[model samples]
Target chain A: MQGKTGSESWQEVWDKSVNGPRALIDCWQEIPCDPCQEACAQGSIVLSSGICAPPALHAETCNGCGKCVAICPGMAIFLVDRSIGSGLARVTVPYEMRDEIRLGGEAWAVDGEGNYLAEGRITRVSGAGRPGRTMLLTIEVPEEWALKVRGVRGRRKLLEEPEEVEAIEAVEDFAFCRCEEIDYSRLREIITQGEFRSLPALRRFSRAGLGYCQGRFCQSILRSQFLADCPEEDREVESFRVRAPVRPVKLSRLGGEDG
Target chain B: MSLPCEQLDLLVIGAGPAGLCAAYEAAAVGCRVTIVDENDKAGGQLSKQIHRFFGSSHHGAGKRGIEIAEELFGDCLKLGVDVRLSSSVLGLFSNGEVMIDAPTQLCLVNPGAVIVATGASEKSLAFPGWTLPGVMGAGAAQTLINIHRILPGSRVLMVGSGNVGLIVSYQLLQAGAEVVGVVDTAGSISGYQVHAGRVRREGIPVYLGHRLLSARGSTGLEEVLVEAIEDGTVKRFEADVLCLAVGMSPLCDLAAMRDCRMVYEDALGGLVPWHGADMRTSQSPVYIAGDASGVEEASVAMEEGRIAGISAAEDLGSLNSGEAAERRAAIAKRLDELRAGPHSRGKLAAKERLYAR
Candidate 1:
């Protein structure tokens, strides 16, 4: 069994890829989740580290059950069988879109990143006409391309690819601080004139981060702007200064006086 | 006249997912809990989320966020937690004094312990004509569409391909608004591929490696100019609404006001109050959880809430040490699982630095 402390290695995953039909989980990220384990009645899926651990399958125990396929919130689980006669593989994927999915039809198969891969024949479609549910689509693909096909989409006209052009200069002056109406031009001038090294210095000189929102909106923007122009050595120490009364309070309130 | 300062055992601020879960855990342990929020309603941003959440069943995965918020709030109420809505905590003093502006009166609270779950706010991107009426945060448009049942505009241009941008774009389409396209500066999709696929299936082109240069109109937003960052190719789309889903920053103002040690963590949405694994800040009586602690999934926030809540309860002698440790271990493991994903490496490291005393 693969230990929970370490992620599943290729050998462990390969060992579980049995000859018959089995579930293939494409989930690589350690998303803290485990509904797939609960969905498997045969106890085929092992979650040694509770819900957050990725589901580990025992090849011998899995019965090609598709319960885990529909329940995965990420829709990363798939059912595949490469040994089903006729040089072809059957791959089942979850579909949640509202498009019309038909059986005995052709669809464009896509890779894990949603890029168009190859065309596959749709053999079966389940859970249609149900609202708020995941539909499973089984497609027949070339045995060589079975592992790569993640999902299928209808043949739609793709937008023209963006063309290459010369680098453009920064556009017209835009406000950096909305509450104070401090635009970018004014910020650049202040940064040079005041020789502001930190956010507090700039805030003290320009009143850019002293608005009602308490620099929540402007601080990040200002930091990005400063870092883009500042020397590399001074970049690490540049950040906003946090102070009290995070919310706007009347002076009377601070004095403990009744409103 | 101002009401005299009231001494309480525990006070939780911002009755969102984290705060609600915190209140529930502490109150379940037979500790008196009083929760306050600025909004008239208890669910903070959870009420505006129409998309189904993703996590284990314990985090309400597969359930819509709105449903989870209702369930969490309901659980807190059933436990007899005192919930004050439209009651904003004006200021949190260094001495543990909390000044609250209730709907009817001004009150001061001196609590034995405080849990700050104030959550995070949407980060905005500025461009020409960005201040136009139709140019707004994606969350604002989501609130308008999902909560208020009003479409922000007819044709929308979404900037940022993160989960919020993708989900809100899908939601906009579901609400009968046309999503012109989604623009992002990154070459690859940043959010989950499943979410990106949902929009791609609908023929909504995701313009990757592109940055929004400007929004233009006479009065309201009418069009947006997007330029490819790689080669500077510019494209313009006619859009009445330009929704920015760039990112979010943790709402740590209250924590900062409490004189808690602060640190700059880019992964945690910039500056955040430093805290330990138990969710207690450097300040003895102050604790924090949820997005306010650091922006993560509501599921992670809920788990952190339980940790903070139980820690407070145990500190106040409401729970035994053995029981608190057991519960903490389970939650810590869950947190580890959540942060186990490769994408969370930076966040996990940032949290480690935060947890270091």
Candidate 2:
């Protein structure tokens, strides 16, 4: 439940990252994963209680090779070195986006929550040649912000306007039932007018649930649209009546006729 | 023509991560297993999972889901399990008659023991343009990109910050699409911090406290509108595709039709068939496993399927009760270990409640 790196193990595990390029793992939850432990060649990471336990990082044994960064499924591991320069630090982040990250290029640095902190330069790009592998982007930032910079912004920008092309037009007023083409407005009108207490009653009146999907797609939508506003005491009883032939069956097949 | 009534030793529904493991386990014990799935493929949702799984090596950890699915199905085939793809089970009658709509013909199967591993369905989010062509489920987009190698769109906006949402957002980035952002109504991320961190470190903003207002598009999806849950401020982003990674509902329509007692567990998504620790439903000869029982990790589903298969085999006299109990104990230990994490504590409690009920 702890978001961000907690202070209980931060001083013991992450202080060595300031000395040299060491793995600064922020994994706090007990996830059943051990790829980082297997990925480390120096025996730096240990999962003492099998795979379900949270991994412990042996900072002194970590050589900052960035292998754990690439193999970590959570992308919680980072390599930081405050001793890279006099006042500059280098942080290696696991990058998976298909952006053309140029070496020695200016990139916007981000913190743990993905907030833009400061501009950093991409100093090295590793695992670029390997396909389907997580590449590491090493960024050079201020020495004080080395531990803070966890990631860098990709080059892709959000689209301001989408191209207009008609693929499927709106036939009805937000139809939840695609097969029956019963609009949400129509269902709401029927539910209010008919005073239907159950979903089967509404289905008989509006034919919303009687579709090829057998209400598989629109059942929840119907429940939320109608019963969501009902009184809490009355809300628990209304459920879609599941009948025989749960899936759509051919009339011929139901009649014991072979196809 | 009369419908042929076929007698089956064991029948497993779905053929996904759960059903395949169930069929494999039962067939390994010499219980003539027949697995049926509506899809043409056997692996179900696992075919779309390109990212590696996050369990121990016993469950094929570090291997991609696609690989694990292939290995499971291959093992089932080696055991001579009959995997009928493109087949649907229409109904489960009280007299142990299961009406199946197979690719070839309509038939009735009288299975001595049945494991309903029907899995879960993606829950849809209702918005103005939610029914649009490009506004699709995140799992559908995953299938398109990972299985079919086709990108759903150039720019995408994902709703929900769960594991599926964050993982699909990362996959969308891998498919060369510009993931504009991931918006969720919750103040904090719902999935593991690692998954959220994985997507966040890619510069994909996790817009926590943002609820989707509507999606606007003329014919297809063109723009998405979100509102800040705290201040009610609106934010618009241009996106050709709007992916809904909302939670899933356990598909138990067949089980419900069979008169199996159902329990409503919010933690397990919705109403699920009441089952015990042995995966046996309230009704005799009916067992439920995987997401059909409760939506949890695929690893847990596979373990549950194995237990169900072993229990069914023992009931069918293919395995002795003592051996079945021993095997189930080992699997139960693994299941407990898989659900020991804080992330899975709610699911574990929900499962125990089902057992207690």
lDDT of 1 by residue, B119-194 (tens): 9988876577777889988999998997889999998989999889999998897787878889999998888766
The two-chain DockQ for each candidate, comma-separated, is 0.28, 0.36
On the 0 to 100 scale, the lDDT of residue B312 in model 2 is 92
Sliding window of 10 residues with minimal summed lDDT for model 2 chain A: A1-10
TM-score of each: 0.81, 0.87
Worst 10 residues of 2 chain B by lDDT: B227-236
lDDT of 2 at A73: 70
lDDT of 1 at A215: 80
**Per-model TM-score of chain B:** 0.98, 0.97
Instruction: Tell me the TM-score of candidate 2's A chain.
Output: 0.71
lDDT value, residue B341 of candidate 2 = 86
